[model samples]
Structure formats: structure tokens, C-alpha cells
Target: NDFPLVLQVGEEVVSLGRIACPIILTTLLIHSRSIVSTLFLSHLGDVELAGGSLALGFYNITGVSVMKGLSAGMDPICGQAFGAKRWAVLSQTYQKMLCLLLLASTLLICLLWLNLEPIFLRHALGAGQPTRAQWTSVIGISLAFGYAILACVFTNFLGEAWGKLYTQDPDVVKLISIGLPIVGLCELGNAPQTAACGVLSGTARPKEGARINLFAFYLVGFPVAILLTFQLKMGYRGLWLGLFSAQVACVSMMLYTLLKTDWKHQAKRAEELTAAVGERDDLEDGLINDSNDER
Candidate 1:
């Protein structure tokens, strides 16, 4: 009841406000979905809900967070390099991120798959434990979903890709606009394919790809998915299915957006490339200088 709300208007403020709202809401929706799923299961029975939440949180904190952190470094690099169109740097970042995500995610998934029930479920149940059928189902569901969570880390790299693409060609934005609706067509089952497309696109395009993904995931993808999931009561399956809708929209948008991008032409122009590279280098140097001064 004591919650406070504030609204203000200014050019810079509005721009930031616009960006902030979607991100906050999207992330909130994700957490809400997780909590609600637990609540739904809880309605079925307390032990089921509590135990489920515990295992979910554990896997997320230990496995999910670690992978996200390890692979997320590409965000800054992609954001900056993409704007600069440093193809060499962008290429390097993509390879490194892919390699890192693969190694880190593999190990995390293995451990999670191995101990889905033992560490997450049984520990929650304590001495007596639930029926074999129940625990077995939990283990199966947990492990089945583990592969999906692994996708999030790779998805992080997409920010860099889309960011670079946006920097290279603004037209891609328009393309993504047209493409988004088609993805919407996939309707309920778009996340896995969409997410995979995003990560690959991000890793490939770095600049525009990452930026597009950030928009799609944080903005279009997530919000749309959240609405479908909550309003339609898609449940766990629905939630995952809804995820695809966002990805499809984003990927299609990016493709349409790419129709306008002429990075190859931009890259071939020596003077333009030099100036762009120099400008980018200056920014990096400035950051390093600032860091040095701070130290």
C-alpha cells in the first residue's frame, strides 16, 4: 500500500525511461513466472511446491549464474566494437565467447544433470522423502529443462551481435520490424529456435545482431512472452513456447534490418574504416586512461 510511483518528462530522461521500463518489467515477469509456476505446483501440494522451488533456485544460482557471468563479458566488447565496426575485434570476441560458453556450459550442465534430484530434490525432502514416482518426475523435469537454461548464456552474446549490426546498418531495424510478426505466428513454441537464432546471430553479427537481440529479448521478446504466459496460462510448457515468439520476432526483424545494412561496403571503404576504427580506438583508449587515472 505504501508503494510509490513517479513520472517525469525530459528528452534524455524519456529515452532512458523508455528503455528502463521494458527491461525491468521483462525481468520481473521472468521472476514472476518462476514464482507463479512454483505457486501453481504448491497449490497441488506444499511439499511439491517448496521442493520444486528449492531445486530451481539452486540450479539457477549455481549453474545459471555461473554460466551467465562467464559468458556475459562479450556484452561490453560487442557493444563497443559493433558501434566501431571493428570486424577483426568482433570476430575475435565471437570466437572467444563461443568457446568460453561451450566449455563453461558443458561442465555446468553435466553437474546439473547428474545431481538434479540428489542435490536439489532429496535434500529438500529430508529423511522420509516423497514417493519414488514423484521424485523421479521431478528429476526428469529438472534435467529435461537443464538443456534449455544452457541456452541463456549463449543468448547473452547476442547483445553484442545485434549492437554491432545496428551500428553497421540502421535499416536492419526496419527489417526486424517486418519480421517480428511472422515470428509471432509461431505463437506458442518460439523460444528454443528463437533463442538459438539469437545467440548464433549475435555471435555472427556482434554489432547489429546483439543490439537487435537486446531489443527483442529485453523489449519485444520478453514482454510478449510474459503476456502470453500469464494471460493464456501456458504453464511451464507455455512459458517455453512463448519464448520462441520473441526470438522469431527479433531474428526476422534483424533480417529485414540487414536488408538495409551494407557493412561489406562500409568495410571496404578504407578512409571511412580508418576513421571509424580510429574513433573506436579513441574510445577504448579513453576508457583505459580514465581507469588508469582512477587507479
Candidate 2:
């Protein structure tokens, strides 16, 4: 009874768990920088907060979207090579994708870093605080989003009860202080959750991602947010708390999945897949060369 016994688990269970864990960790590492920046800006006062929010929004739309989109095409290639055990191709693909992202980030910095003032002004002009009545109606609509950006915007609105867009009210600042940190926590969690999904896709396990998303966000997160925000009268903090809980849950679940993965098998499969892809490319190149020689 005192002896430690090792029980052999099924391969599928192991594979799913191990694959899922790194994805969650990788995602969190990648996304935490932005959320941390937002958290810092939230402490700086209303103008800085709003300007920072606008900058983040612009970065997501222009820079982040482009980078994710371009890099996404490589997922299947990596996944297939991984699954096929093509090690060399997998390594090359991984390196090439990294290079591509670096290039993209450089280009984006050149474009966005130089034009931030204009972007902030454009967003600031459209920014306004709604009354409590308006907010009640707005929250209903905003609850659908994973990150309720409007909640951040309206944290300042708590001070603008008279319907003014800008305010120097201490009450609003007090409310903002309470809500913004929660926003930071929620956003920080989003990184790992999104990275887990990306990893799942790269492993050709999108259904696992779908399942995790449904259970984590809908079953656990959504109810908690509803309960905290509406039932507890916790307001924006409650909603963000719910989001933080969801991210934690998602990370936990994904971690469990990744811990179970058969990495040796995955490596073998990657090597096989990479070799097949390389041969196909060689054949295509040869055919093109032959036609050019004939011409």
C-alpha cells in the first residue's frame, strides 16, 4: 500500500493533454504584454486610458489582424507535418513563420508607431459617456463580447452622470479605479485562452478547441458573469471577474489536455509530413523548370 504505482493511461488522453498545455502557456506569454500595457495606462488618468484603449484597438485591427492572418496559413502546414512526423520540414516551417512575423511586426511598427496621434484623435472625438440609463441598455448588448470594450469606455461614464463626454468628477475616477484592474486581469487571461485555441488548430484538433471554448466560456464564464454583474450588483468588476475565472478555467482544462500528449509520436509524425511536403515541392519545381527549358 505504501509503494508508488504508475498506471499507464490511454494514448489519446495523453496526446490531447500535452498538446493543449503549451498552447495555453504560449498564448499567455504572447498576449500578456499588451494587457500589461493597458493596465499601466488605466492608472494614468482618463485621457491616457482612452488614448491607450484607442491605440490598442487600432493595433488589433491593423497590426495584430494582419500578422495573425498571414501566420495562420502556416498552421495546417505545421500541423500536417507534425502529424506526419516530418521533423525537418516542421523546423523549417516554424523558423520561416517566425521570420515572417518578425518582418510583419517591423512593417507594422513603422506604419502604426508613426501615426498614433492621429489614431488617438480620431477615436477620442467619437468617445462619449452615456448616462446610467443609457449604460443599462448598453450593458445588455455589450455582454456578448469576450472583452467588453464598452465597459472600459463607460468606467469614466460613471462620473459623467450629467451626460457630458468628459468629466473631472472624483466619483467617476473612483469607479474607474475599481473597474480598470479587473479589465486588466480579464485581458491577461485572454492571451492564454486564445493561444490554446491556436495551438489546437496547429495540432489538427480544432474540435477540441471548440469544446474547450463552449465549456469554458459558455458553461462556466457566462453564468458567472451574469451572476456577478446582475445578481451581486458588482457591476463591471463582476463582469471582468467572470471573464478572469473563465480564462483560468480554460487554462486549466487546456493544461490537462497538453500534459497527456505523446510528444515522441508527434515528433515522428511531423518528420513524415515535412518530407512529403518537400518532395511535392521538388516535383512541382522540376515540372516548371522542364517547361521553361522546352520553351
Candidate 3:
């Protein structure tokens, strides 16, 4: 009964208070970390803090736009398969979506990591700016993302499954499983790719649903992404520590979920449902559309 449920409700008021709720929440989440980083920067002097804030604002706008667009693509495919009860289609779509997102993340990591110095230099060069120190921070963030990013693909996977199982198809369950040790081992690798809690929450199978993505992107990931490019404590290393820890926590939860569930019956039901739907559509065959394909 506990899960990320999609709400469908009738329209209500669009009052100023209502309108401002999301906006206020969003701004705070966005600014919090960089605010902390900026506090650190300001102690270094005025110029650094101003540069940190400015560079961060610009990066947030660009990254949020892209992340939302991708969410649209993911939402529709999963929604339709789920509403229509098409398990095989859902599985196949996941495969394609994953491959595409992997390439996209790789490109995103490369572009930001490589251009961060130039990006900050352009904005940080203003008068009274903490130019060199801020530049160092920006460069650091860029390098931190270079680790192999498994990211949170499982979060989305689980979120979709949550809807199907806990809701209309309580009988539906996912067959795919990920072990805790392997998930942890992956986190420790040299590449320092995206880890458990955060990635799983944001990408693979977000339990709090897209809020995980929304929060991680705007709040957690955004500042982390920016700070890596903004400071020099351990250079790139210090910047990524918060984010790495977030993902590790998320991954552990997902792996644990896998071990505790016994819903093979759910998946079996979903599979049967797909076949039943196909049969009811009344093609030329009963259950065997392809004689050679029968299992």
C-alpha cells in the first residue's frame, strides 16, 4: 500500500499561495547547497561568492530544462504500457530508453566536465569577483562527474513497477533483481559512478516518484554538479563526496527491496495478461501467433 502513487484529481484553486508553493520549494532546494558553497566562498572574500552564485544560476537553468524533457519521454511510455497492461512492451521500452539515457548521460558528463572552466571564466571575470578561486571550484566540479556513471536507472524501473503492482495490478511484480553487495561494489569502483540511494531514487526506480528526480536534480544534483565546478578543497574530490554518499544510500534501499519481495506471481500474472489481451484482440491465432516462438 505504501508507494509512489499517481494522483488524478479535479481542478482546484490557483491562488497566489497555491502558485507560490512549488516555486518557493524549488528555489530553496536549488539554492541551498550552492548557498553553503557560496558561504564558504564568501569567507574567501566577496569575489568568489558572487562568482559561485552567478555560475550556479546559469548551470541550473540549462540542466533543469534538459532533465524535464527527458522525464516527459519516460513518463508517457511507461504510463501507456501500464494503463494498457503491456508488460513485454514495457520491458522493451525500458531497454531502449536505458541505452539512450546512458549515451545522453555520457555526453552530458563530457560536455559539462570539459567546458566548465571556460563557462565560469566567462561569468566569473566580472569586476570585484573572486575570479581565480571560483574558477578553481568550477573546474573541480567538472572533473568529479568523469567517473563511470551507473546513475539511478533502477529508480525509474521500480517506480513504474510500483504503480503497476500496488495499484491496478497488485498481481504485477518485477522479475529483475539486483544484489546489495554488487550494488555496493559498483559504487566503490574507480570511476565513482552514480551510486545506490540517489541514482536509484532519481533515475532507476524513484519511490517518492519523480520528486526524487525533481529534488535530486534541482536540490542535490544541481548544487553538487555546480560545486564540483566551483571549489578546490580536495579539488574535484571534495565536491563529489556529498553526491556519492547520496547515491550509495539510495542503492542500498533498492537492493534490499529486491531481496525482501516475493512477487514472481505478480510478473507471471502480468505476462498472462499480455497474452490474454492479444488473444482477445482476435487475430488469426489462439495463443500461438508464431508457432516457432512458443515457450
Candidate 4:
């Protein structure tokens, strides 16, 4: 028997909200570190604020993004394992992911310590349920809209004076006024793209998300940024426009992928992934027990 359409949707919203709310809060809390640091930096001086911002941006690209991306890969494996009641597989997968992240972090530490150039670059699940995917998209898009509105309101309220909050330098304030709004617009794309990524994670298809990101940023976004920044002489504004373009491309692709996703297929894949790991765990356990018996 099927439930009413409204009821089904209501339930989905409630369920997704339950999971999403805590995640939203946790994300805000995590990023609050950087926010707080920026606040402190702003009080130091213009040069200090600028330097701190650059450092934070670099750390985000190299350190935080790397760890977050790698750790996200485990979401599907762990979610599926738990869903299937494969506790051992879940535990093992979690442990392996932690080890992987630790190794990645160590490598990143070395790279950050040695590298000179300003360089670059940059979920989980209901395990492939389409209803969840759709609602998640809706929620993400909704949040993006909300953010855009808030950004606009804040930017207008602060006007060119917004920069004064961070620095006494008129030049710095001018730059902030121009850049801040564009950054806000970019979130129009960033928010939804992030939401779509969550859906992809839940469905055990992080590789696809990665591919989309690569194509969107490198193939589409970067080229556009270059053209606008250098070719058109848009300068910093152009650079931000490039980011906006990238975000738009990324979100479009993400939403399209989610729309076209075959959720049933993903569910089957999740089952298989969890089952294979479960079997391996069982095999390992059996072997260990046999060794103990022999001893």
C-alpha cells in the first residue's frame, strides 16, 4: 500500500531535515574557527587581515578540502554497511578511511611546508533513494536562495562601508565592496552543488561527483576566469566572476546528474558493496579463529 503524496513528501522533509539540520550546525561550527580567526585578524591591521585571509584560503584549499573529500568517500561504504547490519564491515571501513585520511594529511603537511606557489585545489547517504535525492536538491536550492537574499541584504546594508569593519584603508574597503557581492552570488551555485554532492555521496557515487568537480572547475570554470580576469581586464572582479561561472556550471551539472540518476541501480550497488565487505570480514574472522584453534 502507498501513502498519500503529501504525506510521503512531508515524511521525506522531516527525515531529511533531521539529518541535515545537525549537519548544517556542525558545518557552521567547524567553519566558525576560520570566521573567528578572520575577526581577530581584522582587528590587527589591513596587512595582517589580508595575509591571514590568504593563509586561511590556502589552508582551506590544500588541507581542509583534501581531508573532507577523502573522508567523504567513506560515507557510502559506512552507510550501506550500517543499513545492512554489517557492523564489522562498517567498523573496518571507518578505520581504513581514518588511516587513509591520516596518510593524506601527512602528505599535505609536507607539501604545505615545502611548496612555494599559491596553488590549488579542491556526504552520505540514504544509500541511493531517489525521494531523498529530490528532496535534498530542493532543500539545497532553497538554502542557496535564502543565502543569496541574505547576502544581498547584508551587502546593501553595509554598502562600500563594509570594508571599514575590517580595515581603515579606503583601497581595501573598495575592494571588499566589489568582491563581497560577487562572492555572495557565487554561493547561488555553491550551495546547490554541495547539496547535490550529498545526494551523490548517499548513493555511493562519489567518483562521479569528483569527476563533475574536476570538469566544472578545471575544464569550464578556470578557462572562463582566465578570459575574464586577464583577457577582459576585469581584474579581481573578473576572477570572482570566473568563480561564479564555475559554480554555475558545477551546480547545473550536479542537478542534471541527480535528475537523471537511477536510484534503484544505486541501491543495488550499495547492497553489493556492503555485502562484499561483509564477506571479507567474515572470512578474516574465520581465519583468525582457525589460527587460534590451531594454537
Best-matching candidate per TM-score: 4
Q: How far is candidate 2 from the true structure (C-alpha RMSD, Å)?
A: 17.2
Candidate 3: lDDT of 149? 35
Clashes of each: 29, 28, 32, 1
The C-alpha stretches of model 4 lying farther than 4 A from their native spots are 1-4, 102-157, 277-295
Model 2 residue 173 CA deviation in Å: 3.7
> All models: lDDT?
0.45, 0.52, 0.38, 0.66
Off by over 4 Å in 1: 1-9, 83-87, 110-295
Distance from true location, Cα of 60 in model 2, Å? 1.1
Q: What order do you get sorting by lDDT, best first?
A: 4, 2, 1, 3
Cα lDDT tens digits for candidate 1, 1-295? 2121233123323443464467558668857867767657755654776688798889789886776655555543443355445556556656766777778778766331110001211111121222321232223333323434544444433443532332334454444443344334443223433333332222223345556668877787677667776888764444545556565666466546544533333222212222333534433233233332210
Per-model TM against the reference: 0.34, 0.45, 0.28, 0.77
lDDT of 3 by residue, 117-219 (tens): 0122112211112323133222322333332233233333454443332223232222112222223233443222222222222111334334433554466
lDDT of 1 at 54: 93
- Candidate 2, overall lDDT? 0.52
Off-target runs (Cα >4 Å) in candidate 3 are 1-31, 110-295
What's the TM for model 4? 0.77
What are the per-model C-alpha RMSD values against the true structure? Answer: 24.0, 17.2, 25.1, 8.9
Most accurate candidate by lDDT: 4
